[model samples]
Target: MEHFVVSARKYRPQTFKDVVGQQAITNTLQNAIENNHLAQALLFTGPRGVGKTTCARILAKMINSDGSEATSEEDFAFNIFELDAASNNSVDDIRNLTDQVRIPPQVGKYKVYIIDEVHMLSQAAFNAFLKTLEEPPKHCIFILATTEKHKIIPTILSRCQIFDFKRISVKDAKEYLKYIADEQGIQAEDDALHIIAQKADGAMRDALSIFDRVVSFSGKNLTRQAVTENLNVLDYETYFTSTDLILQNKIPELLLQFNSTLSKGFDGHHYISGLASHFRDLLVCKNPSTIELLEVGEQTKVIYQEQAQLASQEFLLKGIQLANDCDLKYKTSKNQRLLVELCLMQLASITFDGEKKNSKHFIIPPSYFKSKGVAPIPVQRPDTISEQPQEPISKEPVTEIKEVPEEVQKPVIEEVVSTPEPVINLSITKPSKSSSGLSLSSIKKKKEHLIKQMDVIIDEEELPKDDFTEEQMVSVWNEYAQRLDKKGEKIMASILQMDVPKLRDNKICIELSNSTLKVELERAQYPLMKYLRKSLNNYDIVLDITVNEEIEKKYAFTTQEKYEKLKEKNPNIELLKKTFGLDI
Candidate 1:
């Protein structure tokens, strides 16, 4: 078998231009070499694998200027020493290095020393090197590299020039990965490369490692499925499927997909994490400026752009929230599957249109996402009730109600005449102290809202005689059932099910399942009575709520009892039946 060197090492960038997505750092380094204005002690710090040590090596090569392998001792232009502080962290090592620094460069004008992971050095070693580091020999230079800059003492940081290496952009990383893929003559799908880039997460070395591992599994033919499966990645297909279902508002289908994912052996937490990342990508892909941050293959990028066109920012935001909620609740939930299922259910309900209200706060249409600002969310109070239908009153009350038209009454005038009902505030909108120590505007707004509500209530005072029909009563039951569901009151909903209500003599008699329900009805009796009296001008007609036996239990008829009832009810009917020659 022929030994195959992985694409990562084979296609490693030799020149500064080849380094991915870090132009700023490369340019600064190149400038320092060209100007001969290099700092003696340089500190390179940032996240791991973002080219801190790599840049240091590059810097070392530039300083010494050896053959193609600038790392060789024979190629040393001066005296350039490279040390791994993780291993050579003793005071003896530092003392020896310091002693050697006093000697002049053997071959070149200035000597260079490079130390990787300098934070690993012992306190005594750092103390030993401090004096030489602060004011070293004129012919000597020093370079220090670390992933965690904070671990290094501030004293050391102040003495050396600091250069921060930023994370490589996804766009920049993809280009480099492409260069490698093309160089290796590998048949890698764009999505395959995108998976490698995403897995790398802005580290060139890590990207290379992932690419190598994937190549080993895929051989020369790198397919999207091969890469994702080998690396245990959640495929873009899953996200695409989920997002499409959500956009279509298919909650059941969404949950089915979620169950399918779980059956495939995917972790709930991982699913949530990927969804968050996917949403993040969609957010970044919203504008041209942010698209550069989206790290995926060219083909996948196109797919994302298409989806972004399909998805609104509002949808992404709400969908992401649902996904995040699933993640947070995943661990604590006893029935983990149900928790995840609920999340998908919630996600499917999210409409990008401004009309979809935030389950958290306000409801706005998805169209609102397109606009520059948000429409204020309407207030909701927990105990608040909407206006009830008109009452059925006697003919006299109808005439009184007909008299109050043709008035655009103002609040300021109305408040003085009638005591205004207080506005229902579900949220705490407590007035804050203002310049004069009282917020009159806030108080006025509350009072005004209250007055308006009272006016609406007063408007329903005019009742027609025998106003509500059975159909109307059933409709009210259904509406209240839905309201109870929204409030998570299943108990109340079940009782409302026995609500085959009828309008009897202007009073509503709702059949109950049992006396328990009848008791609940009685508890609600006062509000029901007041509302009925107001809606129907029949104060004399009282509600005769009863637990009707037929409503309570379903019974079967026995043959003997049926005969007895028939015989008792009609003695003359028997003689007439005998005359008619009738048989039972």
Candidate 2:
């Protein structure tokens, strides 16, 4: 049996030339070394395992390099001082480092001090090293390395020339890993390395660590399956297949895919999230410039490319939106699976502009009216038959109201509805209320002509006239409505829009088509009535609200809906079978 070193340590870089994915920082350092324009202190900061400490070590070895690795005895002593701040983080240790700072280097011209995790140093240690750091010995150079640069004090930061190391990009990381694997003559797949790079999450050392593990699991030969299975990753195949089903409207196949993934222990949320990320990748792949930034195995990339090629730009756009919305709604959702399933179903049905079932409050188009076969009807006044003349000389509404006999009414009332919880008959697309058989114009005439005659005579005998114009009074009314609206009085705002106001027999009458609007308007009558009478110089005014018919727009059911209801009432004598073994 042979013991193998992990790739993280085995393939570690020894010089600035060998450092990966930090060309900007390395180039700057090489330039500084070549020009001999190095600062007294250098700070290296970035994410974990991205070559901070390795670069510091390389810098130390290079600056302290002697004639030979074997012959120079002084190379062992003052050439490099590597300190781990995590362990030696006290004031005494820093004081000792400061004391040793005065000595000139024996082997190299300059002694380099590299402090790893420098942010771990105590406050007292930082304070002790402040002066020595700002003004170190002529023979000494300082290099501080940290994963979190923000934790380091600003005073210390000012003394050093900072170099920020970036995360190893997926492309660079994949390429480097391939180079290493090929050099070792290891059989590996490009997708395997790509997975390792993605899992590395911008850290070179982490990438190498994952590479080492995969190599062990795969022995001398590497396969894409080994990498995905070992890493517990759900491949792009599931996403591609599911999305295809959704796009083709194959909901059964979509659910089958979901059930299989769930049975494999993939969570509903993770599955949805992966679906979201997959759609996002497709979106990115559709664009030329951003495609390079996407992280995926070669096979996955190919799959994405194929989908991107086949899918319309609009399909990808809306699919991504639905997936993202599902992801956001997943946490708080009670039926999470259904939520994801519904999103998938909607995504499958989504056309470029989406299906245009009328939105709530969305007006019906002319085409819809034409399809429903609705025509404008003339308004008719109520008429009585000559035989019913002795019934009454009533001037009330004339709509036919059915009267229920007492014996038959109880069961009808009892059977009207019965449920454990009250069911609210609300509509997402239905117009709220049906129009009453009344007209606004008729109501306005009765208001202005009749109310004005009686109120004008009484107004002259009341308080002073010419105090306020009708518009000013309306503005006052509107202001009151505005104030009420700011206090979450939306109903008041709706009532204010009714707008018709008239005075009859020294009383103010306001006509509203909506009963709810009328109720809300009546609530404001006490304060508004007082304000109006005071402002109008007419104390003989009372506020009255009546329902107006003109604004009461009809709420009609669609032809399809009406047909469905009629069919439900009688049902089909025979079971109607639809396509694909489904009966509707």
Off by over 4 Å in 2: 66-78, 287-290, 297-300, 352-356, 359-584
Q: Candidate 2: how large is its RMSD?
A: 25.8
List model 2 lDDT by residue over 257-352, tens digit each: 888998888888888888878878888898889888678766677778888887778877777777788889999999998887777666755641
**Evaluated with TM-score, which candidate comes out highest?**
2
Instruction: Pick the lDDT winner.
Output: 2
Candidate 2 residue 75 C-alpha distance from true site, Å: 2.0
Which 10 residues in a row give candidate 2 its minimum summed lDDT?
423-432
The per-candidate count of clashes, in order, stands at 17, 4
RMSD of each: 25.1, 25.8
List where candidate 1 sits over 4 angstroms from the true fold: 1-13, 66-74, 280-293, 309-313, 331-334, 351-584
| Candidate 2 local Cα displacement, residue 57, angstroms | 0.5
